[model samples]
Target: MACRQPPLNSKRPRTLLCHDMKGGYLEDRFIQGTNTEDCYIFYHWASIDIFNYFSHHMVTIPPVCWTNAAHKHGVAVLGTFITEWESGKDICESFLSSEDSFRAVADKMVQIAEFYRFDGWLINIENLLCPDAVKNTPIFLRYLTDKMHSSVPGSLVIWYDSVLEDGKLKWQNELNNQNRVFFNACDGMFTNYNWKEEHLQRMVAIAEDRLVDVYVGVDVFARSEVVGGKFETNLSLQMIRKYGFSAALFAPGWVFECLPTNEFHQNQNKFWNLLCDYLPTHSVSMLPFTTSFCQGFGKRLFFRGKEVHAGNWFNLNAQEMQPLFVDQKLAGAGGSWVRTRGCSEDAWNGGCCLLIEGALVSEKPNVSVRLLSLLAQASPRLFISFIYKQDCSDRVRLALEVTTTNSCSCENSQITTPQDHRKGTIPHLLPETDNLVSQFKKQCDTQPVEGWTINCYLLELQESFLENVFVNISRLPDADAKYKEKEEPFAFRVGEIRILDVNSLFAAPVQVQNLTMCNTLWRRGFNDCKKRENQLYLSTTLRWFYPPNTAVNFRIFCKGMEHHQSVTIAESEKMVLIGRAYNRVYRVVDIPIPDPPVGTSGQVEFLVQPITKEGFVGQSSNCSRLVVNYLEKQ
Candidate 1:
């Protein structure tokens, strides 16, 4: 997915994130489901939102995953260009041999920046250079900086505090004359993390006009130098701010990579909060939407904002509103299992859904999601959409069980209300019971072979509903005698579980129409649909009733046959721009259509979700399907 360059922020004390995890990107999974805005609340005041993908390579482009995740949080991401160790010295020698050679390399680097859509690069030259090479290095840096600025506006080229003007690999750890020459050529410099208080003061003095450009480095994992790394991290942050310098935090992945698995989220919070204590509190806006589930699009397992490369996990539930719940104890303990196979396309806006199937035990397993108070106060309507499929010809029943406590007001106790509420026991409160507010059932069809149908249940909440409510999708007891003895469990898959505020006047509805599909191939740099069986693409036209400058997004969901069962192939696109356009716009999306499962007719289903620019997902359009029986002969 190509993206436009992020806007520049002139905020002071900018925080640069140097992401280095296990030799850089090895077994690295960027699953940012948690609200990072809340995690780094201190960063709101200080511009703490630049992510740099750090690796010891000649040309390291930031991965699409990192770019997508960072952009979602309104953060800028940068790739790395480093020349380190013996091989790097050779690379620098060949590139800086002549002025023309240097200029040619700089142009190529500029081309890479335009192609990848990252903001800029962090140039780290950590190897010794010859006198001739060192003299031309500044020229090369100047050329690269000028070309990059011209090609990609608002782009940055940060220099690491390594290598001196005398052609030697030295860590100055301060903004002195030895490194001042190189620093002057780039946008900023990242100082070595092993600097002292005097060094920071000296650097601040040296960078009098551009204090924000000099970023003091802090290594959160290196305990040998920084005693009590977590607390010391706060001290470094304080000292950098006191000296009027930006901060560069290196290797923050230590919170996940080194800490205990269960305590990863807690330790991460504590570590960040220590930094927060030094800085003034700032209120970051809560995310407009949040959801919790154990399953994802690919085979990789992501739970509680952490990704495990290898696992066919089932029944692992993460915590609500917090990012620390990787419960391995319940792995495969199984009352509810996620069925990646035969899963229908997600009916809602997200990439994947909870494909659950199992018999209800004496204590029914339930997953509770915490909703924001904004949602409750808005008195929004909740919609639970899922696909139900079963072997028996019996009706499948499920319900939304809401657990809320009611607060009663006294007749003439306005003065006593505060004390009663604080005691957690209102004298006039009524006893509350769990209410089965909404129920949904799918009746047996005429042909009872295994099949699925989409169902939706809506429940509108009032202000009386408590802050935290648990909506459980549980199986109701069967009354039929004949089917009661059957051991086979009924299966149902949840697609879109959303809470929407329909009361807002600005919340206009969007409609998707005129869906079409065709087979296409990339020939001569353009899509040609003349040839069949090359690739499948779908196009749809959308209409919305919103004013100009309103941002709208369309997400396409596709389901195809895999191993004789329907499984989701394409969930959603990464950050497609449908915003700022007038009333109607047509979008063409690639549909991932695999060969039909054995003994099954080739078919695919497409669904579209229209969402607001603020991340509020709307209802799913009715499925627009295509049958590919023509490919069977081929």
Candidate 2:
């Protein structure tokens, strides 16, 4: 069950995001559950390297949705293995009874991580252990670490700084001899949040070469003597960086939990933006890269430039590789504002798209945003494609920012007016003083959805490798003095971005094998569900498999038809996207089968469509389907 995928091993100071919610498991726990209600989602994957799903449960496995999203950005996902309170103390006694029991427990933990396909575990032992159990605690930690490393290479087992060597449950707040034994046993240690400046200095002294391995914990909720958290969480992050240590941000979802739902997205971005200078950005190395700029959760669902489902939904599995946007602050200069965020109002590919809306000022007429940190070797036949649209008439020139090995200077480069490049133009290269290069392309295809236009340009790269790519938007410099007087408003949206080697495009993965449905349950009617009065609620598990990473994910849809008395009309035959599956297994809970007349039968055909990393859909012939028959019982 070990995930053969390589684990995260960042040389820079790492950032571990520990998600601690009020109630651990929610709609996300069902894996493919269709959630209409409001849910919390983390989209700043580039800001952090490790994500730990934590709860009070003894085995808090990260839901597959989180794992899928995290893994897409090369971020490692970890589940919490915690013991707390009175009952936890008893659980520890049983596990730490003897050497064999401890090893067995460690093996089980490793198996869980392997089966779940997550990176590793966050060992948070918050309960007291007896004298004998304490003696065996380090033994358990060592065995778990060894097994995890061997079974899942590059996997991690981070210990929490809680228990003292004397068996007492004491929060040392930093690395010391009191809890150094456990730190030595594990890959890294997440220190408690109450640590002071002196504690951090001492921690650095003790950590020595392994300073990055010791995660200085910061409670975003501002518990204990933690310097600053919540809106000011960056204060603590800056301090942590000054001392040269990794950070463990506990409950970074404070924006979702504390702020209003309407403000969640803005506040979340603001919170992370504060730490931009402190945390290192993760680079994209994998090929066939694509992103719709989807935040994964949205008010409506759109697929392939069309609206598919019109209901509020949250699914981290569907989240694309988010663009690393740095907020541009004008500092109260006229009506000028330059910002970028995910918009649910419209999308060309998925549920959301990247929206850049703002007015231009004399000081900052053009906004150049860094889209991605890429480490890629460009081939001769490489293609870069993206869809964009301008909402306003203020003509703006668009350019792509790229970094090459050759030094090219943009010091004397002037901003140009928007041009009609319907037949493609040679990219404008900088002179020989800078590494940054700006390239522009011609419009290729116009999407049916709104005014979105697609641009696919073949890169005739003179250099071999690229370090980054950015999105640049600029306006023409007018000679009239009134040009600066009028703050030009521009609203542009990028629907999707795709980078691939044209000649070596990967073949679509084979169809899912062993397609089957089991544990089917049908419900007739419930009084509380007046909205779905005649809907037959069918709960089932649709299991299918393609290899791991065969395709990014499988989009589950149903072509259902309910039979009537006189004629078998195609009532429910409209293709409906029921849910999405990151893994092979998807639970079909409450797939509303329209109520048929008594004694009449109905059939539902579930389709599994694989979507690749480069936004390529598998052939219809290669799709797997499951047929389910339901009869109305008197």
Candidate 3:
């Protein structure tokens, strides 16, 4: 349902900390361009993988690169965690189930947090309770709280559900006795999207009078048809507090969660303007949109006739084709046709379209279907436009990210920016953002508090973009490549991406190593532990861009080899590389590099080739170790 927006340029900022765009991954701080003001809720997910990736960039990286810039602008950086839904059903699913696991994961997360100077974790309480997980959740939270506080005291922990319950509405963890105890363990709590106004008011009053702080939570999309109004709404911070809400979490739609890109403007930028009025460094998401690929008029038959190829770093989840093409396009112009290996048809194809004349076939010949599974989250919009080429201009296709459900459009907005000079109202010139931020800073210096974001949910995605291993889509024999069994460029392409949730940091430390490659089947990075064997496998279908053929030699990393019988790619002597885990605790491993392929572009695979017991004993935690270089006839 459509909701009313406050005046674009109001005399004062509104109530609430208008959450910046964080469908989840954050964009650059300076990428912002708006006038509204509100505190920002910077959403960042943490895991062993990302911790290692960003940690190395921390020292040279300025505070602005981390959370300091947001803080300077009165913004709060909340590091939300992505976890396994099974854990909420039982503590066994905890990330820190074992002492060894807990130590490794916790230490890494804390150290990374410390290195980046992050404020706190925007804890995903739901994932912990996705299944029958309510019982063990409290234990897990308390355990997590203790783990975090042990290293950094007063770390603000934001609960997805309400936590404050002081009498007189003070923040006193006065909810359910059990929940209150667990909630009290946190400095603040955010209500779920299911919360009503009365409950919200009570929670707000308590935050103001009883508790040190209060936060409200909102889902990226209608996780399950929100009980009330439109989901991604943002009111000003002052207005929110005065309206009886301590803070607001103006999260964007699902689009922001998968791949932050330009399509998320409606949900992301709208809130940024509304909140930047208060928060110094607001976080906005630019989730990748399928529209990025498509270019046609209207929604029907887009990408009708155009040869399309994915970029080397193409993220399927955020990809689309425009100018709908007919069946001919799927049949590659050069004898290529639609082919499905394993999985549903929708899951295999991206989208289909075709355009032709009475007796002419100048349109897209064959249109490949979209991979419609979980990857197709964005409802892409098509815009058919033309470009000027040499002699005559062809239809230079493009797509736009506009998913408003035909309702809830910000265009022709009822609210307008005030043109006349007017005096500031209660919210126009909010000093509370700075006040709140300042107060938060002082508290951190003295004693850290658990974090909070009112009525908002945060999921800490590990590789927000799946980076798993995928071997044998195309052939890789040393540095030579062949396509369609013909002399072609060798390429390593990625297909469906399978991801693992590691939000249970304090509960279970994960040993993510072991990469095996042979024949058509390459299995690497397997969790060797007995208990984990079942729950630790994540692999995607190989796109097989590289054709297997040719007689050539290649090495992944020659500088660090233990023996002369070097490692190789799956199946052939033509390709060889090494995969090792230097420090198992750091979840760091290196991928072997082979000689560059001759005349071919390849895709990056998230799969790893584990070192056989006899090969090597040391592994590097750095991803740089995984090499992907092939020369063309060099």
Candidate 4:
């Protein structure tokens, strides 16, 4: 195929971007924010259960064959190369022993650039521990730039500075920034997430005035892939740049949880800096504990004291994270069902409140409310988990509906025209949602109120993820418009929230039994290394399929209770016991959490099948039984 020629009138400079891992860019738009009309996601970090040790040290980045398919689109295609762990030792170690590895990688990058003909390079200097850590990195960067510049002179190099975060006046950010200046290197940089506005100003000021040919890059964890003609992340980039700062996408890792396999039209695509792509995004912080929005999935509803401020799905920056050596095991629960934040001084628990809502509120008059917009790109089941206190004066209503282009000329689909079933039950197959529309509408008439107890609610809808109401009236002036198009805040008291993709449950093994007991004991005697040793029972409530009368073999995967993703089971032995001997089946394995799995995740999945050679009796019915069990949750 012939490579397309660049337009002569185009003034945007060409650039080279190298991140640590591979972020296959897809051109799909799922979310829309301010200037994100031309924005797309790159990659965000992987799930604790999904991303672990083996993927950390090195990676092989694949070319973006999908991005090249778009012949008419004017957007530029960029690739990345990243560094694992912000540890300088890791970076040096990778390049130290094998010079050939670096050369081979560099050669591959050149080949990719020549082949794909991307817009420019998103050069990242990821995860710098301090100035001392990255001092030698500039040497490598300068040499790499020299080689790269020799060929791709028009290529831009964007660096991610880690030193200037909210706290810790570390030497790394300055060292890297100054080194880029000393070498007359770097086209621009993706500014840190937590740095102050003033810090951002100074960085941009220095890049434009001090550095010969540099700019400031703002990294956005946009809520969606497309806003206008591009991904939604661009809106944030545009907003930040107007303040004299440029920007780029902080890529979300592998899967697009918001999108289902059917909606495979790649709408959420863009490039982001990776850890191995450069350094981890956290390690690349330029400020200290600046406490900004951390990337998340599903949808987010923000609360300040007793009011809801803003709510939207969070777009993750996968490329900016380091792979965990020991990852958490996946709990077979669907999208986040709960949320809460705690005071920095809260004594109840540390980050425990991170999963609850309402705990983060202050004792002030109620103000605004925020509601989340569900994704249409994929099937979504919103589960909200938060702790509500008595006499809180705020009524939390959870509802979901279908969303579609609703202009008068637009055709009606399941999302746009939902069937009106019972007033509150789940809307069967339509693109809408069934919400836990708070029955406790009025502020409780009693302390330790009836509705204030801790509870988990399952809300499924064929509709949408948004509604227009403050408290519970469906008429808040400030609610987001995905449902009604109003733009006002709602009142809410919150802690943290957990949003799970209902389907994600399929890949996770079944939780055998309650670990609350094991968890408590482990915390005490387990040497702080709370790895447990038990083949805890899987609650067996929900599952895709269950085997019957089988002697087939499989093992149980175990882990700590508090730590869902970290497996404590020895890979060698994993067979779990279930049922009695006669009707007792021993060969049930791969007990996946049901699609839209319900109930709080609690054990082990066994590979069960019949000892019969007669093609396994009742295979089909067995599957049906499994589905029935899953749907009949408490």
Candidate 5:
């Protein structure tokens, strides 16, 4: 129902995302920090869970996770109100029989939208309608839109290009007079896939003023009709833009479904980057980021260490990045539960810990928890905290390993090399036996000291590397004989794996200074350079110094003085990590000149914030603040 709030006004051509595959569950992969500028609306396909026109059971509400994630990106989300086959035909006949029947259906649809917090509905009437029902279809749609708009100001009602005004189940792949009647009744129209270039041009002409309303459909994996299916999806986008029309990318989950599991992240990026090639980046400012992991709090399935909630699947959203599992499986035939004394207390946020009672032993040497996504581009000084309970006979050992490259091989030697630099990779290497036990003793207070001990391991990598970090637990080889008699399995519970930024622990903040401006034509003897004087092209460079081992990547943000709280303009690419204890100069090009306040000099001030390789900024700066003041040239 209509639980979603209104989205911000967008200047880019609308990019409508149609969620249809695997029953709208696969869109989870897109939540991770991906660019979403062109995505104006997200449509969760088909509301045929049940087949009553007036019952909420028949309404297919958009998943709450999709609504939350889409709205966070300022994109509107819609649920499908669909009718198909004989049941759909019967429902439509009842829905369109009279004015009261039409109002009843419209009010129910609005109520569903309100309950679910979604923006609107996608009316897909794919069944053939009788002559009387066909004649009143527009009236029903118009009434629905009017009621929806009056109740939810920024709500939408998209007309799927399925049924025409004449009540025929014909797919008009373009906007013509046949479908223009319905388009005029709703917010916009989703063109059916298989449209020609001329069709796009014709639709664009018809949508002269509201050209963004026309979303040309491009099915990324619809083998029969989609052109340039995989990495070449840009071809369809190029044509849509050529005619100044919006684009609807159907089933982007093809990247995940078709590619090998190990190559999912790489292939997903390659596919979406093709879309970025055609769509411009929207200038929206994002807040500082933080992520933490906890199991048993809110999780659905556990594959090893990765835990995903059943109904909630949007893991890409920054806020929902926790409760990850690596390789969880059902407790098998050999697995047996045992009574454990205490649970490991959660280290990040105080919560109940996850208990491991069954025989966790397997043919595999270790079970690992991945931490790279949280540690990517982060400071080298990191802390991992978890709670576990182990007796003197317990043989389980916890090891922390980091792999620098994206190779799926878990071999320690292969991880050190800079072979494939993509994001997904396998866990590699275990801590040395001596180091593992010693570190555990140093970090944790075991049984005699306390029933369940909290362990916090502090790690400092020597160099900044794009790497995947994993925490693994393995059984020691020598302890099997001790359990031979009664076959009692060793049990332990693990709390959350908290990734702490150790750089923030240091009391001293870095210092920044020496800001200077330069024009494109500036040279040693170019002071007298003569081009169009009014058309000045300027860039700025600044120097900053961090304490030993505290180097971090930084970005410059600018905003107009009058709109101090408005969206900040990111003016520079991330500066590479500075060398320890050294002064580094960063140059930003094509910086937009901000308007000065009414009575002040023509000067603009910008803030420089340090960011991790993973694009995380701390809520508060432990580092010194750097606000550069630039004066306008007279």
Candidate 6:
């Protein structure tokens, strides 16, 4: 559970999305599961700096899926430790009863976060506190904050704006003297959602230099005096930015819960698009930058351009680094424009691909889409490669637009200077014009997979680092074309992208070892048939070991086989995506007995595949596997 990922260290005005839907937990609680139905998965990790998995439960730990997805995008994820109502009063009395007990509870929270590999917690107490509990509240918050910081380097413990210091359950709606004590006890505070313009101004004054720490609350459901929630949540976001305060958007999942299911994807993008302009931007600084623009859910699953599983599936852990796509509405005046989003209908890799589709009219011949934001150091010799399928006749150009500066020292040499210099490659001697350098690559003859073209470009930097990458799509000039009459159609799907140091060689991760299953829970269920024959389902936690720092992601796959089979054959077995893991531990749920028969057992083989931070997956032969007995109902 030791976190290998870096922590959030930005000082900009940030956005923290608190996800709350219905009650506490649901299908996502299973972590990894066989269910392939549509689920509420947050894809706007680039816009938000932090994510809080909120619910009414007393100790609401975020599912590993949320943590994995958020961390993959360089976003921090937090769990909720909340107590509310009459039952919460009893719980508070027991935890806040004595100094030792409150400290012990705080320690337990730290342990939970360490084991789950999440960032931190959001402490919410909504019930009236007794005199003794009120006296111990600040003590508890201070202890939790100090412990979390020490235990998990950049972790946070934010106090919600409720329960006044006088032991009254009063909502101040702003950071005032009543709750300033609690704010002083933790990293920051989440103001009540009913806050007004004056409240924001007052909180800014109270927060002083830590202004960004005070996350002004915005309830997306439009509940109780909440300004511009739901579709117009941007109003609150804009106002918060105007006052120089961070934002905590509660229940942004309103798009999934209240909107039409069929239009969830588009509507979700639209909703986030409205607020994206008001939120702060985040950049990827790590080297070997890569992404498929996958939102981590799809109608089916594909690996290296071939179909792996054909079923509707969603697992946030499978999400890759998302792109900051330009809003279609703001792209143009309708003459020509391109809109990009993850398309699950088809993909060259993973479950989704970046779909760039638009029209080119007489007025507009080419469209440039800003794809990714990078702060990585450009190597002396750099190699950039990507996979895409051009479904239209229009020509597409992908380029890296870099703005580099000469550092005081040769720090870039440590990050990416080429050690191996061979023939046919040259140093990037091209002079920078207007402080910007653009590197472009043409479609090569290499086709590692069918239906996709690979484009690779090499650049050698003297002392500069990368800043941004952009993709341009243009219509090739045709003498017979009649662009003045009609608008031409253009579409492309980018399945994979990688920027690597030419000198850096890829080392496949060591095979996973010590694979084990524990805490197994089984359930008796009936199939979809009318016969009502009994079936067995399984839920268990899987653990394995791999050499440290070998990979950033682990993909868990399972296949069913006859118990009598001793040798594992590839073509005869179907590999299903059970889920993904950020670390060695993963919990799988509701794995139905494939073709379960009365009193018959089979063998299940689980495979662990390690994937590098730059999307390079290890060879199947180098991966590890475990076979477990599947017992059917007698």
For residues 99-202, write the lDDT of model 1, one tens digit per residue: 99999988888898788777788889889988888898888888888888898877788889999999899987788989888888878898887888889767
Which candidate wins on lDDT? 2
Error (Å) of candidate 5 at residue 14 is 1.2
Which whole-number lDDT from 0 to 100 does residue 306 have in model 4? 26
TM-score of every candidate: 0.55, 0.85, 0.31, 0.30, 0.45, 0.82
Error of 3 at 24 (Å): 6.9
The model with the greater lDDT, 4 or 5, is 5
Clashing pairs in 2: 408-434, 409-431, 409-433, 409-434
lDDT of every model, 2 decimals: 0.50, 0.74, 0.28, 0.29, 0.50, 0.73
Error of 1 at 67 (Å): 1.6
- Whose TM-score is greatest here? 2
lDDT of 3 by residue, 323-413 (tens): 1111221222343332211110111112221211111112222121221111211122111111111111122111111111222211211
The better candidate by TM-score, 4 or 6, is 6
Give the Cα-based TM-score of candidate 5 against the true structure.
Answer: 0.45
TM-score ranking from best candidate downward: 2, 6, 1, 5, 3, 4
**Candidate 4 per-residue C-alpha lDDT over 1-634 given as tens digits, one digit per residue, 9 for 90 to 100:** 1111222112222221222223332222211112221223332221100111111323323233213221112223445555544463366445533556556555666666566554344444344434443443444455555556666544444455543332122333222444444335444454434443455455554555533232333223333333211234334434344453333333332223334533321332222211212211111111000111122222222221221112223222111111111111112322212222222211111111111222111112122122221112223464333343332223333333222221111111111112321122332222212223232111111123333333333446554422211111122232433533322223222232323234332222232222111111111122223353332222332222234322221122222222233223234543322321112322222222222223443222333322121111222222221211112235
lDDT score for residue 214 of model 1: 86
Instruction: Summarize candidate 2's per-residue lDDT along 1-634 as a digit string, tens digits.
Output: 1111122464578899999988578767756545556778788777788899998878999888788788778888889888898898899999898999999888888898899889889998898989988889888999999999998777899999998988899999999989899999889999999988888888878998888899999999997678899888888988899988999999988988988977888888899878888877666566667788887777788776778778787777788888776566555455556677788898876678988777777665666555665555566656676678778755566667555543321111112222411122333433323221122221112234657776656666755555556666777786778775787787888888777776534333466677898898988665354564555678888888787665767888887634344224365457677777777788877766666656666667788888765566766776797776666666
Better of 3 and 5 by lDDT: 5
Mind giving the per-residue lDDT tens digits that candidate 5 earns over 1-634?
Answer: 2111111233346667665655543334342222221121221111001110111224677655466544533456778888888898999899888889888989998988887677788788889998888888888889898888888767778788988778889998988988888888877788888887778867767777777778787778866765555677789989888877777777676776666745654465456545654553221112122223221122232211222123222233222222222213323424433321112132222122434443444443345444323223445665444544454355566555544432212221111212333443333222434454344333222222245454545556555443454544555565456443332354455543444455433334334444443433321222223432333233555555433323324444543323222233234432222111112444554443333334443434444555332223323343334444433344
Runs off by more than 4 Å, candidate 4:
1-60, 70-76, 86-88, 94-108, 111-136, 163-183, 209-235, 252-634
The global Cα lDDT (0 to 1) of model 4 is 0.29
lDDT of 6 by residue, 330-350 (tens): 234356666788788888766
Model 6 residue pairs with clashes: 428-460
